[model samples]
Target: MSMKLLAGSLIAAALTLAWGSPGLAGPARPLLLAQASQSAEDIFWQSVQNSTDPAMFQAYLDQVANGTFKGVYKPLAEIKLRALGKTAAPATPAPETTAQDRTTPPPATEPATPPPTQTAQDAASSPDIEACDRAAAHAMDDQKPANLPGVTFDKLDTSAAITACLRATKLADAPSREFFQLGRSYDKAGNYKEAMVAYKAAMEKGHKRAIYNVATGLMKTQRGVKKDPAAALALMERAVDEKVMFALSGLGDYYRLGVGGRRNYPKAIDYYNQAIAAGDSQGYVGLAIMTYDGTGIPRNRNKACDLWQKGSSLGDSNAADYSKRYCRYR
Candidate 1:
């Protein structure tokens, strides 16, 4: 049959179902079915002309009846009968099952447990945590370059590593072994800037080695703050106060070379005596040179030769060479 004739038949059936007998109706039912029929006709004709899939077209019709056509039309029951298809009755729903007859119980659920909280004391007492705190303390205590013991640099990168170590140590409230390591590292790296900082930090923390290192680094590089000879002299003096043998030797050299602002041969001699008293042979060699050169003191070649012999006996190589060439009397 033509789509128009089929649509007219479906509309007639819908109106009959909506109005019941039509002989005795209080008010005619709303023209819902008539409108729904017109909509359904438009969709069906468009789908057919467009060659839509038969299954999809049927599903579309079913959705229209259940959704947009819902409330406005008689239930799917009368609508299905009126639709252009072979008639079939709606299927009945199965009976509900009882609780006892249910197949399985839902899986058992565990009660949620909150995580334990740590007290401050408990946290402090934790072994792992205590170790970290101790390590940090050590690093802060040893942050100075000069105070570090047994520092041997294998390469420039080793020095860079030391700088990094010192930087890490500086963040702590006290000097640590790590700080000393850092200072040594920078010194090895030839990064005198960071090395001086690390040594000063160590010195401030009461590290004797760092005090000496600060003096030496400052003297060597003439950097980190102003290049003050007076300051270097003061630092070397402080190192002497600590009774460090190498610092005494360094002080003697500084005086002998007229560094740290002034030339004083007598002062140099005094410093060299201090170094010699501390069992440094190099001090003897310096004293011998001053006598040999007649620098600031009266010329005394014989006295110089005698001092060189004494220095050679203490394993000073320069003294040995001078004695071999000039101290035949010895």
Candidate 2:
């Protein structure tokens, strides 16, 4: 299926529950309200118990937003959001900054020679590199969600990760994925120059996420790399074609922020929605910021709150902060 059609189907599937009827009525209102109140309490505590999983918190917000229950748990939800990431901002900015300080890309360099693929047989013959993978794995890795725990860029322990990844890279059975993780470690550690080298190495081995990282470097014009928004956007388009989920959101940001020297609100919204459909919660955060600011979209504080609430539920701290700061429920 095409990306757009696929996105539409996925979006429809995601909203299936959201669009369902609550089944409240005059005769059953009292009993239903009591049931809903209990359900809300149960869900809120459940989210608190599994605070590590943002989806739990999102469930509670979903209930409240959909009118299944009163928003009594909102305050506690805000607390959870704060604990998960940075403190809430005092006020909303006009345009949310797309520049990620921790994961900024470095200059492109000579590509590393591709190593032999680490097949299952090779891995079985060598010492397990699970420790290195655990230390350096990134949340944005398209291949990691099912096999490993992914850490956010800001949350990474760069020192430990870098050491593990460096050791992993020296192994004869090391694969392209290790180099990508090593680049992520360096980027998070603010060693963009080294990060670029590792990313190029990963790229030479056909690591798709490395392409996104290189494109980001070109977009941000930091890390000793010359600015090339056009090149960055082109690379992102290619990454999207290669099924890199992060590239979907990255494209949304580019159009949203005029990174390519021209803002395209319609294109931005399309990309953001597509990203959200693809299960990238950052898409919700970007769209919510645009909604809050009324930039190329109708200004709807409530809609923005709903968007942030969804993004927060998906483990985005920035989304949680925005929802906390702006999603005031009466």
Candidate 3:
């Protein structure tokens, strides 16, 4: 009997040591089940946290409905409440209390109250519209093209400036000077298309400089219109008629080169003479070449030599070479 009692005490001590002590051989079954439950809950929470869209969340909820979760699958609202550090009860719906025992009044069946009507001044001064207007003005002022000295017309960025300028002129009701300035800006920005449009608008407003610019620009690029050399010739002729010396020289070149129409040597010589009379050294060289080669007039070596000497003195390279090679009195 004493040996049996000793055996029973030993069995009880072994069972206590195996189940309760850290030095035990293996985990208790209940402890293993609890760990598994916690791990499953962690996986569920991870799925919820990683879900980016409603579809993914619904898929995860379906997994819970199919009993894929080893532990309890809490309601999403309860999860949210827990995330907010609130004490959340289980989602099992409570039994409905008796109506007489309810403290809060029932929701009204009537429609909601309408908002107050705004006055005309209040409507006009709406913050959203005012903010939009201010933003648009800021964009206009910020994006308008600026001029820089020494920057060539071919190197400018005109697309953004043209867009902003057009917006400012149309929406902001800018002045004629604004349109003219925008056209000049477009010209400087290398946007001939926008420049032509802007110049036309300015011309409609009676801007004379804009008219000159449009004519010159069309002459330069032949934008929209066909490349009419006669039109170009006529435009330069007008400038010449207005006593523009450079225009006279250009007309002489045009006639000499037969640019617009038939090559009229006499007309070329006549224009060259006019340019020379206007005291242009390049024009003198042009006339000297014509006389030296019997191109537009009778060959006169003496006159050629005199013109060459005059042009050479004024820094004309061709005339200087001619004076050195053919006009040197040896």
All models: lDDT? 0.57, 0.71, 0.55
* Superposition TM-score, candidate 2 onto the true structure: 0.58
lDDT of 1: 0.57
Candidate 2 lowest-lDDT run of ten: 26-35
List TM-score per model, in order: 0.45, 0.58, 0.35
Candidate 1, which segments miss by more than 4 Å at Cα?
A: 1-177, 220-226, 298-330
Lowest summed-lDDT stretch of 10 residues in model 1?
A: 71-80
Hey, what RMSD does candidate 2 come out at? 26.3
Question: Which ten-residue region of model 3 has the weakest summed lDDT?
Answer: 135-144
Q: Please, what are the lDDT tens digits per residue for candidate 3 over residues 99-162?
A: 7759768877898799866554453345432322222221112222232122233443444344
Deviation (Å) of 8 in candidate 3: 89
> Which candidate has the highest TM-score of all?
2
Q: Tens digit of lDDT per residue, candidate 1, span 182-218?
A: 5666566454655676667767767776776777666
